[model samples]
Every structure is written in C-alpha cells, then in structure tokens.
Target: LAVEPDIWFLDEPFSALDPLIRREMQDEFLRLQDILKKTIVFITHDFDEAIRLADRIAIMKDGAVIQIGTPEDLIINPATEYVAEFTRDVSRAKVFSARMVMRPLAPDEKGSLGELLKHDVKVQEFADQAVNSEDRIGVTDDAGSIIGVIDRQSVLNVLVGRESAGSY
Candidate 1:
C-alpha cells in the first residue's frame, strides 16, 4: 500500500516477523528515517526497539501514557519506579547521549570542541576514544560551536550508574 499521510502511525509493524527479519527491518527503517525524516507515530511494546528507533519515547500502560522522554532521559532519570524497572537492564553507556553527562568547558579549554565529539553522539560510541585521550572530549552543535565537554570520568560514571539522581 502507498500512503502519503503527513504522519505515519505504525502499530507493531514488525511484531509478526521473526527476530532476525525484525532486526533487519529495524535497521532498514532507521536508514529510511535518516532520509525521509518523516513524523512517525510508531507504536511498539518492545523497549529495546523503542530505544533504538525513537528520538523521544512515550510509554503507555493500561491505556494511559505513563512517561515521555528521550532514551537517555528515561534511563538516567526515570519518572517512577515502574519506569525505573523498565530501564533497569539497559546498558546505560549504549543508551545515554553525550548531552546527558557533558560539562561546560573550563576557561583553559576554550576553542577545543573540535578535539572531540558532537553533543548528539551516544556515550558508548565515543567512550573508548574519550578514555584514551588526555583531555576531555568536546561536544559541539550543528553550527560548529562548542557547547559542552565530557571527560573519561563522566563517561565512566554513566556506564557504572554512579551519578546521583538529577545530575544530568
């Protein structure tokens, strides 16, 4: 079927597929989104799939929307115990973005954002590189402007869940 609605509401589009095919479709869907950039109202019960596909996720239970947040926000600061339990087994480094743990650049670190990563990068994507570098990794904006910095320690904190609540 060919539809051109302004918004796409996909309810468990991959539910019936085998796990391998579902994963392949997930990858293909993500690739399509990178090009289409459509406003998609994708519905799924799989937390891992939701985390993988969403820029923001709205979780519902018993037909009521329970919480809404990015993957990192939901993982790092769940709104309730129910939400916490849902995120408990997620590898935080793979879920949290650089924006969640980055600090403002110190005076001595001016003009250094080019030395590291963009603010939107996932923490796990750069963890190894950050750990091996002597200085903090710089997070930048689309305009090539420095926004924040993240150190190996901060990245490690998220990996180990050592950061106190509300620290992000």
Candidate 2:
C-alpha cells in the first residue's frame, strides 16, 4: 500500500460511516498497519481514535503540537491533567497490548477458556462481558501467545461501575 502512494491523505475516511462501520474500519486500519508500516499523517478530530493508532500522538492545538508522546507516556504523565483526563476516558487495558500489561502466564496455568478479546482492544470493551463471566478472560499478543489473564470482575468494576460513578 505504501509503495504505491507517494503521499496518501484520506480526509476523514470513516467520517461518513455509521458508528459500527467506522469501528470496523478502525480495526481494519490497524490490521493493515501490520503489513505496511507507513509514515502516515492521519487526521482526525477524535482523540480516542488518534491515541488508538498512533505510535507517537501529537495532540494539536491551533496548528501546533501541544504535546507528543506514546499513549502510555501521555496518560501516565500528561503535560497537564487536562490531557490526562482526556486519556482517562480511554481504557488502558483495552488499548495497550498484552506485552504492555501482561505478566508471563505460569507454567502450571492450564485451561482452554473461550476466545478472549484482542490484547490490543480496550478493557472497557469487555466490561459488560466480564460482568457475565465468572472466569478470567485470556489476554493474547499478536503472536498468539497466552501472556496473561484479565480478572473479569475487576474490569467491570473499573470500566463501568466506578467509571460511571466517578464521572459524576
């Protein structure tokens, strides 16, 4: 894809899409990135999406970068909590990979639980599902390694229950 495009600028490629399709496109975009690591200058007004895709996100203001860093860096040490608050809405467990959050699964750990969501997907995504499952949700890397397990109940408490209450 990169070799063909001297420069590619998609103007809100998913802007017109319905929310569900837009989401599908976002996932598709991530999948494409695996095969083509292009230097892209994707533009979007959505902070959540920007942080999701960017290796180094530049939060722009008035035609300049107000801050630029990896998602974790920005979240943990926002230039200000304003940025932190913006990031807080995004579930770190979902957006970050197993490599970022996972401890090595013990050798004795065993069980073929059902399919877990992608490690790259936000934990907030699993909040509802977690509430229903008594067992831990497996976390896997892109290489398909069973790196860790997410405590389902914990995710529900953080992403839904506490999060909604904290917003008030």
Candidate 3:
C-alpha cells in the first residue's frame, strides 16, 4: 500500500493469523481499500472472508473457474450443485438486501408507509422489525425517495429459502 499500486494480488495474506487478529487485519484492509480504491485480487480459502472482502467472487474448481459473480448472485442462483453446496449453510438474510426482496409500489397503493429502510440494508438487520409489523415497510434509495416496500411475507420467504433475491 505504501507504493500505491493500481492492483494488488494477495494470496492467503491473513490465513496464518489468529481469528481475532485476522478479523482486525480484514477491517484494516477494508479501510485501506476504501481510501485507495485499487483493484484487488484477493485469494483466500475462507468463504466468509471472501464474502466480506470481495465485491465480486470467482469460485474455482480443479484450477478451472466454475462461477463468477457478486456474492448475492452466487447465493441466489448457484451455477451448479457444487456451488449450491458451497453456499447451502450461508444465511440469506445476511447476503440479501431490502431492495432485493422489496415489491414495487402499486399504482393504487397510497397511504402511510410507516418506517423506512434504506435499499442497501441487509434483511438480517431489520428482520424482527419487518416480521412483527402488520404493514409493509418502505425502502428508500440514495436520494431518500421511496422505491419499494417490504412485508412480513417477503422477509419470511427469505429466511425460509422460499424466495430468491432475483425474484423481485
């Protein structure tokens, strides 16, 4: 980072560190990346780390790339059984955002929208609030304009794996 290269190729950079230190390093790495905005090719066997660090991930098998996409893509639509198995245990609520599950405002629907959630907020962050509420919660974009709404059924569908992020 001192030299400020345009791209970084890191292989298992924090694999040997203890869990706590590895997390700290990951945080520091994210901070640097935010400031540097450099393209990074991070190689790690840790799935959680890959999800945390990568904007797009390429899953390889036997030296061949099997699938490449954003974390949400892989989670919502696994390319193969291998890919599905790889993400089977992952929590959808953690990967999916409110925008992914929200329904567009209906033409005749006009009333109080209740509490609003940002488009990029993960389902896990507001699962309880959404599930317990009788009315749909509004979702907003960067400009704070209401773009869509999320309901209890939508949140439940994600938690139960009955719906895909792309379905919306």
By TM-score, the best candidate is 3
Can you give the TM-score per candidate against the true fold? Answer: 0.84, 0.62, 0.90
In the range 1-168, model 1's lDDT, one tens digit per residue, is 167566788999999999999999999999988887788999998888898899999977688889899887787678888888988888877777787789888888876544657777888899888878777788888887777889889988877778755677
Q: How should the candidates be ordered by TM-score, best one leading?
A: 3, 1, 2
- What lDDT would each prediction earn against the true structure? 0.82, 0.64, 0.89
* Whole-model lDDT, model 3: 0.89
lDDT of 2 by residue, 1-168 (tens): 636774456666777889999899999998887777666778887777777767877776568777788876776567865676677776665554433443445666538455565666665566566667776667786887777766654565454424332221
Model 3 pairs whose backbones collide: none
Candidate 1 vs candidate 3, TM-score winner: 3
- Model 1 / residue 147 / CA error / Å: 1.9
Which pairs clash in the backbone of model 2? Answer: 94-121, 94-122, 94-123
Provide the lDDT at 148 for model 3.
91
Q: Indicate the residue-level lDDT of 4 in model 1.
A: 54
Model 2, residue 90: what's the lDDT? 69
Stretches off by above 4 angstroms in model 3 are: 107-110
* Local accuracy of candidate 3 as per-residue lDDT tens digits, 112-141: 677899999989999999898887899999
Q: What is the alpha-carbon RMSD of candidate 1 to the true structure?
A: 2.4
Question: How high is the lDDT of residue 95 in model 2?
Answer: 51
RMSD of each: 2.4, 5.3, 1.8
